[model samples]
Target chain A: MTIAPDRLSPFQDEFYSALMQAHEGLTEAQSHALNARLVLMMANRIGDLDSLVDILKTARSYEHG
Target chain B: MAYDYTPFPYVSPPGLTAPEARHRVVIVGAGPIGLAMAIDLAQRGVASVVLDDNNVVSVGSRAICWAKRTLEIFDRLGVGERMLAKGVTWKIGRQFHGAEEVYSFDLLPEEGHKYPAFINLQQYYAEEYLVDRARDFPELIDLRFKNKVVAHEDRGNHVALTVETPEGTYSLQTEYLLACDGAGSATRERMGLDFTGQTFQEQFLIADIEMDESPFGPDPVPERWFWFDPPFHAGKSALLHAQPDNIYRIDLQLDVDADGKAEAAPEKVIPRIKAIVGDKPFRLDWVSVYKFRCIKLDRFVHNRVIFVGDSAHVVSPFGARGGNGGIQDIDNLGWKLVAVLAGEADERLIETYHDERSHGSAENILNSSRATNFMTPKTPIEALFRAEVLRLAHDQPFARKLLNSGRLSVPCSLEGFPLQTPGTGAVPSGRAVVDAPINGPEGDGWLLEQVQTGGFTLVGFGDVQLPEVDGIARVGINQRSADYPCFTALKGLAIRRYGEGRAYLFRPDGHVCASFTAPEADAILAARARAMGAELEPSR
Candidate 1:
């Protein structure tokens, strides 16, 4: 199955800069907390259940440590 | 500490001593929903005969959390101010994890709305208000107590029902039969429809404790406090809500192994109350232990027999959706039934009631079930997810938004509805009319009060000209002497909401049916017809 990317990521660079700035002086626990918060915020903005489920599956589809 | 349970005078009914003329509408059950349904019907000029097995209001402080939208609907039904005066208004909710505050949210941060985010009034008071309001329509509302519906059959055009009165049993007929008969509905049971959904294994002890002292310390503003893992109830959820007359509703999640009988006893409940309130003097006003469920019928409309309120659907109490959702259903269905009986719209208009309300009910069930799952995890993995969310909520604003301690009920938008004429603005088509303070012919009133005056309203902003449409009331905002009723938006809230030179058409139920940058006669007529569940004509 293919899901075309339709997110408003035109300001991806600025968003990324702000995201990094949000965790500038945070420890490991604080950084993880920030990321979790970011994920939750983005998920709420994208309220469609199917889209959220697909996004979750896509995120888990990759390998991470 | 207990409320004085005033029993309504139950006069014995004549049942079918002599076959009376067919009732325009017959509503079974005189609970809040049934009473509201009758009142809504009466306001739309349709009379109803209300039958109830019992002649009293709810005995307990059940369904205390009346949502803002429900209060708005209650306003239209002529009891909003009374409920507001008697109810504890609260908007902020605090969520705690293990005796530590994780997050808090304000439900209605915006202003200019008439009702608060939520009002904690006992269901008995709500029923009393509704019943009293129903009495105002003495000619329209025929309330029969101790008259129980034993059997009913939808006879295509009408429903023939068997009634059992205190005197004797008799049969009668009604044009439209509304089964407002609650969750344990005898009507639903007789229909052989399965009311099935998620029934949790975890039981909750619901108790109303009467005390003058505030558990949250001095000067306690009424607010909801939900605990994911309070110290008193480790690993379980606890909830506290303030109600009118110094009564407080406390719900503690009980283990599946917990005895229902023992948990309800004062000896056992008092200890749990002590753990939470700590030596606080309180009397047990009411106590019950039960599991919650989310369930609904496949189809609400079956010929002339229609199911309203809990007879049609039920959701977990966590979200305050049960009574609130039923009131919304009554609000949605009342007008269409009025039109159908009056021959203004086709009987198909009644189907939209099912279509739109089923959507609302399903969303309520989904949200309530999700909240229930988060509160009572059925598995270790689920519990871990909930715990992590709560922990993350302590530090992350986004996670706090994700914390769903039963997201309080709101009016469901009918977006993508067949009736809606789409547009762009704050007041979108299919959305409920947002209340704004306005200076009408009378000193002052809310937008909803004005909207409640007439049939489908065409609210025009700033000299927007509209074509003459029958059965459509025209209201000019910020414009006077325009051959229509005019209102000066006191704070310019209504004008700002609809934008300049734009017109929004609201359905009879206060939902926006269409919006027009410029009012077009043919288009407006088409939308109006479609709102009545008639298909659009090809010519238009």
Candidate 2:
């Protein structure tokens, strides 16, 4: 339920910038679409069903927190 | 400089003047596959006739990426070392998004193997090498250039072929006919067989350019460079590979509606080259426009005729599977065909060729198809996914793994196939033998070279004394004091790859059929029998 330590440790800012730049020219709908696709893609990269389920719960909990 | 396409001398065949005796095997098309098939058969003390319409090696750098597994197979056919020596060896692959590099992967990080991950030698060179090697067994391999197979008939026990030579058309007969006639297979066409698969509409423009300056920047090293939405060619994918003789292969994705004729023209192609190479002086060696097609025949075997290479199946060139898979088909079929012809194995054994290779081709098709989809996304949603995947890959390790310009070709595991007796070990059953360095009483040599020349091999590792099995060659590793041929596992690589105190049974094609922790003669015999299709079940 926790992010791996130093997941993006050295390139944290670069990753954040790249993530923002991905949606730079897109409209709100387009940005949403890109994010949706990114989520699905990242989920597939994760690959494990159990890990994805836990990550989903953790993500929802963070939203309320 | 471009390759000189020197045509092989065509001689008048005996069939032109009079009918010849029935050959054991007749291989159609003298391309890489046909030449390799002939060489493989000749090596096993079997004679074969190789016929081709063209005398010269294939034009252009059609297939440049020779995978390690395919190289090993070629090594067995006696041309691997030559091809490797002439090829531009490369292992690293870099994927870029626009101007920024997303990631790079090292295909062969670990050493101690005979061949590298890949070598970029043009198909023409490969065909030439195979032709020369085939000539080594002149008496066994009757290579008839400029002789085309116009028609062939399956006459129950044997197949009769009508070959059209420069002199005149003549009749020839063979116990088995091997069709290596490529994608537009005349053999398959004449037989009226069903060739089916998906075709992607997206077209790609491929060109081979000769340049003094390196496109890979200062002090350039030969490596596969792939670009997605490159700055030079916006909104399109491009690929660059280095070949021998200062030649570079550049493939740029084109619009689906783009005319191949117009796109391939120098007028259109020169500018595209300029955009990528940037004002660098370069000469165009070859230019071509091709659409992706993943097609294959329903069955590779039909009566007395067997299909090999592109004649059996076709896939997109992205994965370099087309030529590699074809070479593998020869590797699997060569031994079985020899055994069957020698009356050592049942005729049913040839059917396993279809079983194993069809599965291998299907795997190749599936992989190439998936890579094509990723490179050229079809639907809008698919495009979105691809775009995001590329975007995320810039810094994300997880996303980087998802980046696939093309998943390069590797040996297809034949695990659980009909011929293999199921067993588990470091090498495992039905997997191609992994090469390692070893020092024999004679001299230092490669493991594959020692065991994979021909016939069943029983390889014992560490202190395990090899059991004597009739008709099988026994090799002991790290048994310095043994009587038969033995090797000292250099740096313990052999023992590391194949576990200590274990033994392995390898097929004639250099595939592991069974492994044992305890060396038993009976178990080895049974595994050998299974690998020979003695216990073969009814066709699936």
Candidate 3:
């Protein structure tokens, strides 16, 4: 799915930019290291993604129906 | 690869003596608050020492409920994921009167936070997580366990502390001292600060038990379950909270005639639980009695030493506000301490910690007292009122407001002061922006999210230029989207009324320092300077 620029928000964009920057100019091993950090950071920052997904899905479904 | 070594002689003997080596800041009590301060100072590259009488982080469950704000603080320290993993996330709470279901509320429905409603993790686990994280910065923080502060003298320039450890007594001098030494703070007592408030005549017995019959059923709800009436007793109620693992925290009302005090015996609690849940067998893991009291110190600062956490003020645990309030206290004090130590602000800036936190503590105390009054009714009239309110909430949305008032944890605004810039419109109170996501130019999440970045945040709705305040960041967001997802529907009108063209200056701990219609760089800087006790030219 395509990420909306506005939907990402400036804060979310900054986080995404930081994560992408960490991945740049890295060896395969280094990229993996940064990826692990990003995963944990994302998990902590956006807790229980399933719940958020459910929320967004419900909102979308209600709007459509 | 030899490290430089220098042995300093002991300054004080066994009891109390003047500190020989002066530190930038000295934090008393190695509990969560002290550790949090150490982490905050360490992030700012300031050196500090955290002293505690207990050698190890606590393993017991002193506090179980972790608020959304605090989870964000833990996230900044980079351990929030680990905590979230181990904790139980709850959003819905069921309130019952005897066997009759009165009303229920969904915490998650009121959305703007990126974090969940709340997490139930033992306090000891949080402390251990912090202690583990602190290992990365050994130089920035000196964790001295089993070291007790026996005496302290506030010299005009610095505070002299006398600490006694098992290794022998020693004196350490520090530029400033933070007393987070619990409710019966020795430092506060020694400094002659009076902690005045009303103590409930009734005592509550709290037990963490493993039970076969789930009082809340098997569905799992994050909201606090309250049973208002019982056949055995008229006014007595029981509070059941689902903690991590198979553990459940049960708070039962005790009769004045019970054989022993509530906390003294485990047997005192089991009978009460059995009376409510019938013959449900259970094994008690831990039990204690809490004497509910709503007390605040008249002043939070005594000389160069400032109080934080339970040392400064304490609230009734009915609302689970004590630990959350204490952590927020450190969040308030941490940034100011950083500014002072880094020479960005003056030492007088530390006084705001006293001014702002004291107010926050008083509010929490008032909220907790109100919750306690509702939970355990003292008079028949009060009981009738509480019953009617709960019953009405089942039908009316307005009635839900009274029940939900104390549940939501929102930061208090620092508006209407000379230091803050007053705009033409009214500033949103706690209710209006209660569930709004911590959003601005920086991003959208909870207030703790911004604080985790360990710097000040400038939240402006309209086109406000970024100010030149040191250690502060500015974020400009569309006023339309400022309403948080969870609270959008709940407070849409309120946000529109008061939030237009406003700018809020949030401290690293997430409380607002100064807010304005437009960014007033001079006023904001001056307020920060005053809070940090920094030397800045007066702005006319």
Candidate 4:
């Protein structure tokens, strides 16, 4: 049973705003550090090393593909 | 068949020549939101003078999608059943990437709830029903048609309004002023408040065509079909919805350079309709070409005047959030205004209305703006991401989850508010009441209908005894308990929705204020006091 009709990310605007807010005051070097810490925090929350690695590889693949 | 645009009779008011006595509340605008505002206030036993610039109901099938939560609020105001009986009820929605269907969903899988997930009824019919319902309290709801508000000023504790009519002009004084006007609110314009948000330049053709043919295959039982770049209309999105009277609402995206007047013409629109629905003979019931903006006022409440519906917040129509959101605004504002008017609470209660509904409107704006942005991306990068998502959505399930087509309106959760007791249960505080079917002394009835609209209701489920509190009605739900005005859950539906051994406190607007595992007198009273915004902070 589909609980909500739109399976899409209904929160695109919400997450986009949050991302901009997170980078609002940070410099380029600080932003890199923030991104790294954010990724690690999210990975820890996910707690699945295999899926995390797969997503990490997928992110890198998007740069060239 | 086109809806008859018969204007309502506009009787000349005595105030046409002489100044009238100060009214408690004056609502400007007679659209669905404004009419419903009058009805909701009347239901709460507070009288309001509803003034509209126009006498007729809305011109077209504008704001057609009424969500389930809005239905509950409408039921409280005494017009839910009428709209339900006339509206086309649909729970199924199918999304498509080109000709292939990506996903189909059933919004409400389980039964026993009072209303359906959504209903499609023209805004005119809903407003007519609300106007008729308002007549039920003829003494309270003084609906004046063809009355226009030329200007207004908030006089510290009261507001003075200069109104113009066909006969002449008159002045009115009221304790509070309510702007239930449409998106182009005269009150909002006059106030010159900041209505900041994104405005999309792309045009959309909204046509209500009446044809005996069904769009949803054969056996069309009211369903929503959305297509992204259909074969008939390439490189543009299209939506088809069924309403009552064999009329269908079709929305097609037009490019930024599309001519508004030329597109609305029959020569241009007929081919589009014929393209969508092959040889189905149809008549154009109503047609318009428009662009929507998702904008909102910085504050809904400004001194003695308050804004509700499109006047306070406007959203793109894709998600069916516009009218439904306005209904929610009225539902939130009704009892608070009544309380403040009756001197039952401090004026501070109005501030909570601002807090809760502003949060609600912001959420609506965000969802709608995101959907608009996705549909008509201004930047090439945004368009690429959207197209990729749509393309991958054809096969990849994860990508299908990224397709945004207007998240339908649902009640906003006011979880972290100061009014709530701040605890967890099946349904936590500050969230609207979710309905369940129940069997009681009156036979079969829904849980939402059993609760009070303008007063506090304490509902205890399964073996839980409710505390006797003042101004709060008591309700107990069990399989067999009939001792203290209790209801039999019949098949334990209420128990499923609301777990056993917990008592819930519902405010007048049918939103939960607090919940307790055990009956506590002091805690319940304190929470009630906070919800009313009457008493000062109790040594917090």
Best prediction by lDDT:
2
* Cα error, candidate 2, residue B418 (Å): 2.0
Give the DockQ (2 decimals) of all models.
0.04, 0.07, 0.01, 0.13
* Clash number for candidate 4: 1
Residue A8's C-alpha lDDT in candidate 4?
A: 32
Candidate 3 residue spans exceeding 4 A from truth: A1-65, B1-20, B211-214, B231-234, B257-264, B275-281, B379-408, B424-452, B459-505, B512-540
What tens digits encode model 1's per-residue C-alpha lDDT throughout B152-263? Answer: 9998789999998878888888999999999999998998998888898889999998899987678899899999989998888999999988988999999999999988
lDDT of 1 by residue, A1-65 (tens): 22334232334323423544566566767767877898999889988999888867744543240
Which tens-of-lDDT digit does each residue in B1-540 have in candidate 4? 778988999989768867788999999998888888888888778888999988999888888999999999988888899999999999988899889999777888988888999999998899889888888998998989989999999998899999999988899999999999889899998998888788889899999999987777688788888888889899889999999999999999998999999999999999999998899789998999989898988889888999999999998988888888889899888998898888888888888888899999889988888777777766544555568778656656666666667777888888888777787889988999989888877899888987755699989989777878778888888835544578888578888888988889999988899898897788889888888884545321
DockQ (0 to 1) for model 2: 0.07
Clash totals for all models, in order?
A: 0, 0, 21, 1
The digit string of per-residue lDDT tens for model 3 on B360-477 reads 7877876677666556555444444466656654544444444422344545455543233333444421111232454434444543443346676666654444555666776544
What digit string (tens of lDDT, one per residue) describes model 2 on residues B1-540? 778999899899998887899999999999999999999999999999999999999999999999999999998888999999999999999999999998898989998899999999999999889888988998999999999999899999999999898888999999999999999999999989988779999999999999999998879999999999999999999999999999999999999999999999999999999998998999999999999999988888897999999999999999899999999999999999999999999888999999999999998997787778779866554577678768667655766777778778989999989788888789879899999999976788899897796999999998788777789999989876665688888999999999988899999999999998887899889999999999987655
Using alpha carbons, what is the TM-score of model 2?
0.91
**Model 4 regions lying over 4 Å from their true place:** A1-65, B479-483, B534-540
Model 3 chain B is weakest, by summed lDDT over 10 consecutive residues, at B1-10
Better of 3 and 4 by TM-score: 4
Model 1 lDDT at residue A15: 41
Q: Which is better, 2 or 3, measured by TM-score?
A: 2
Report the lDDT tens digits of candidate 4 across residue range A1-65: 11223433555456644654566566666767777898899899989988777777755654464
Model 1 regions more than 4 Å off: A1-65, B536-540
